[model samples]
Target: MPTAKRPPKPPPKPYHHGNLRETLLVAADAVLAERGAQGLTLRDVAKAAGVSHAAPYHHFASLNDLLAAVAERAFGLLAQALEQAATEPDTAERMLKINDAYVACALARPAQFRLMFGPLLARKHDYPEFKVAAERAFGVVLTAACAHDPERGPELALTGWSLAHGLSNLLIDGALEGLPIPVGPGEGLARQLAVRALGVTGAAA
Candidate 1:
């Protein structure tokens, strides 16, 4: 005798406790990780989220809006990581650790990292929340840099951030796989630079 048909699966709820907005953001982040920014769209996010195509519209006005929200979430997470990384009392060592945290956070969420810096979203200036989150994340680094040198804090922060960002991308893309030096987030040249910036040298470095 033929077996009876299996029961149908339940449809996804439109929102869980009025959290479709967060649900959409989570779905968008997953889609971006799985398929990159080019593949992130409201319909796709809805499909991934197991929600109706119209569900995303109820939360995000447009793809750019969703993208900004996703980026904003990433920046918030990065800021938290940076804040926690400054635990060591030694300021120079703390700076390096913060840089390492920044790199590690990027490596942990490479897709989000790219989205945070990519041009797909409308200029961050147009998105107040996005701008605040980005600045707050950057402020962590700036705070450390300014403490290292009040006269040149902004420039130093940019230099350090640029180094960490480039290093993260290189590692994420597998470009640093064969380097002869022992690889690390902020152990070598990055550490040296951090120490030098604070005028720490030799054994202290």
Candidate 2:
């Protein structure tokens, strides 16, 4: 008598989310918001995205890869926010708007902003997309600064970036509250500081 053997199960049907990459990115963002960068994991992202634990591997080789993607997206958003300031007819106003946008973006997404600028993710060479997006965002500021002062454009751009970045970190860490600035709210205070940093008083009128 010969024993009958059952056929092997089909390879578990490779979990298919219609837009898995975007889904994973969205899931990663949510995880970042709730758990911060240290708590993020491919498994957690997959679970959040409603997919198999191994699904993230299809799009990301490692946790860093996933984080890099998230950073890239954050930079793109920051670039868009900065670009909005370019719409102002006046260069000084535009620079001020750009500074405002930088702080606003960081405040709006503290976790993402931290991850984007954190030391652990400092290896820009490892993430070309992130590098490109970051450069584009910086370029917006540089362009606006150049418009404000052609001779000091490059120097002013760096200064403005440093100022905005410092303010963002301060605000996010709650260090700005202790400062002796007479402002009604955190946003207003940030705007005022940003304007002064850029030396853009034209918009003040």
Candidate 3:
């Protein structure tokens, strides 16, 4: 006689995380990593989280909402990296360290970095949390710059930030490869460029 058909597998147990909001955020990050912001979507995030497509809607209203959350986390991490570099007492060294940290963060998570600064997610008014986190991260550089030059703190901060941001984009976009600099490690080359361009001295190799 033919064996009876096997019972259907349980419906995936409805994918449960202790905190669904946080679960969605984690899943969103993974999706952002594999696919840039343009490719990210609420349905995709929900699928990655192993929940129904509607599940993400419970935590996020739209793709922008999810992106804002992910960008907030990215800014927080960038802030921590800058803060760690701020521990250096020397002004030039501190600035260089902060710049290096910024570049390192970009290199470590290019997709997340791009999402953090991308036009869609950078709308400060629309995403207060993203704005706040970004401001806090920027404050690290501001503080370092002020410590270096009391007379031109704001200007110095702007300059430092511009340089770092430009370098990060170039590195991420693979534009640095066209430079005439010797073919050293990417991070080393990046750090060297930041130090030299910023006139920072006493930076560790």
Candidate 4:
């Protein structure tokens, strides 16, 4: 007449109900950092996130969708950094600030930075809202370029955008590392040279 033993309980699932989208995005970034873009996969992200295989699909319809989201977030951050840099008392200073900010943000977020400038997201060029946000961010440089020379605003804007964008990409690719230079130094030097060339002054460093 031995007593029967109680049944053992099943272990609890790992995922919480909230924040799954953010979790998936973070996992995607980690994978991107570790493996670059080629090896990224939704199932792999879901596994990294400690969620069910179907969980990531709920957040991102496809791997491209996830990459697009990552690019969007990176763009948002780039926009904020530009805006923050644009808070100078004068136009010349504002432009330099925004330029510097853009370079800094790229260095800080190289993975997202790469995907933003990379060719994958180029397929979504038809998306108006994406174009709009991109334009607004570009406008920061445009405004700055105009400040440098109103008559050459359009040309100068393109120049500034290309320079800033190029500088950031180079830094992210490690082409500019260990050169006895700082992130803001080259930008500051460029500003000084521009000011000298354009006969302008009064930008906050």
Candidate 5:
């Protein structure tokens, strides 16, 4: 008599269904928020996602790939926020909205923020998609800046970007609060002064 054999069991899936890429990115984001890029690892993310250690490889070949994905998501969100901010009527008002939007986005998503702007993941040039996404996000601010200063559009865009980038960096690093600028309802006094220096007038008198 011959014995019958049973088929092998199917492999288990990752914790989340339908969107493993997003799950890995979310796990990576949590690692970034808590331990930063240096401390992040594919194994750690896999563990966080309750998947096999090699499961991440199905979506991201290496840690940098996962990181680039994180950056791409961040840039998309930033572009949307800035675009919305720039929609305000007055140029100054629009600029102010953009300024606030940048900082708010960073604060709201610190992990994504660090990945987008922090030096820890400084190999941005190596990732073309990440670079393109970054440029898209920056273009939002540049457009608003140009709209505010048509005569010197390019320079104005750079100036506004510098000011907003520097301010966002400072706020993220806790340096803005220590600045000597006035606070409270006059919270944006420094930003107003900087915009004026770039020849962009504030809202109507």
Candidate 6:
């Protein structure tokens, strides 16, 4: 008689329970915050999650996919922040709040800030959700700018974006502290520059 054969053991699971996709996303953000976007790797994310190297692939096809997910969430939050800022009744106050909100959000999450705007995610457009999220975030500022200056809304929005984006970069790099500007704070400087560019002499008053 032949010896009885035993069934093979079941393959290990990445996680025994709970959502693996959410776990990978959380792990990816930790790697991003620790290593920065340029140095991030899917394998490192898997390690952060205590999973196999190939585990990230189950949720994200590549590093870009992971980045897209991260950026999308960041942008969504940014949109909400700006929307809340836009609720100020006074126009000048609204502008100040908008700039404040933008910079505050960036300051609160400097790691995600870099990844969201850096060239590391050149393929971000490949992800529809990411693009939609980005547009919504930008639309908030654009709406505020347009409401402030209807005739040159598009141009005003671009100018405001240029100042805000540049200001955020400077603030992140710790390069704005010594700047010789009349404004008291980085966000104030952003509003002043934006107001000047928007031709709002009264607002600057």
Estimated TM-score per prediction?
Answer: 0.82, 0.88, 0.87, 0.79, 0.80, 0.83
The candidate that wins on lDDT is 2
What lDDT does the true structure give each of the candidates?
A: 0.81, 0.85, 0.84, 0.73, 0.75, 0.78
Arrange candidates by lDDT, highest first: which order?
2, 3, 1, 6, 5, 4
Q: For residues 22-116, what per-residue lDDT tens digits would candidate 3 score against the true structure?
A: 98999889988888888678989888888888888787888888888898999999999999999998888888888888888988999999888
Overall local distance difference test of candidate 2: 0.85
Q: Give the alpha carbon lDDT tens digit for every residue of 88-174 in model 4.
A: 768777766666677778777777788877775576574445556666788877777776678898886776677777777776676
Write down the worst ten-residue block by lDDT for model 6: 196-205
Encode model 6's per-residue lDDT on 32-118: one tens digit a residue: 888888877888888998887887788788888888898888888998999998887666567667777788888788999998887
Error of 5 at 42 (Å): 0.9
Q: How do these models rank on TM-score, best leading?
A: 2, 3, 6, 1, 5, 4
Q: Indicate which candidate wins on TM-score.
A: 2
**Location of the lowest summed lDDT over 10 successive residues in candidate 4:** 196-205
- Per residue, candidate 1 scores C-alpha lDDT tens digits across 1-205 of 9999999999975454368888888889999999989856789999888888888888788998899999999999999999998766666666788877888788789999999998944499989999999999889999987876688888878888888888778877988777897665434655665556545443345
Write down the TM-score for model 1: 0.82
Clashing residue pairs in all predictions, respectively, total 0, 0, 0, 1, 0, 0
The residue-by-residue lDDT of candidate 5 on 15-122, one tens digit each, is 555788888888888887888777789999999887779889988989888888888888988988989978898987787677767767776776678678766247
Q: Which stretches of candidate 1 lie over 4 Å from their true place?
A: 1-17, 120-122, 179-205
Task: Give, for candidate 5, the lowest lDDT window spanning 10 residues.
Answer: 182-191
Q: Across residues 89-158, which tens digit of lDDT does each residue of candidate 2 receive?
A: 8888788778878988999999999999986357988788889988999999999889889999999899
Q: Worst ten-residue run, lDDT, model 2?
A: 181-190
**Where is the poorest 10-residue window by lDDT in model 1?**
196-205
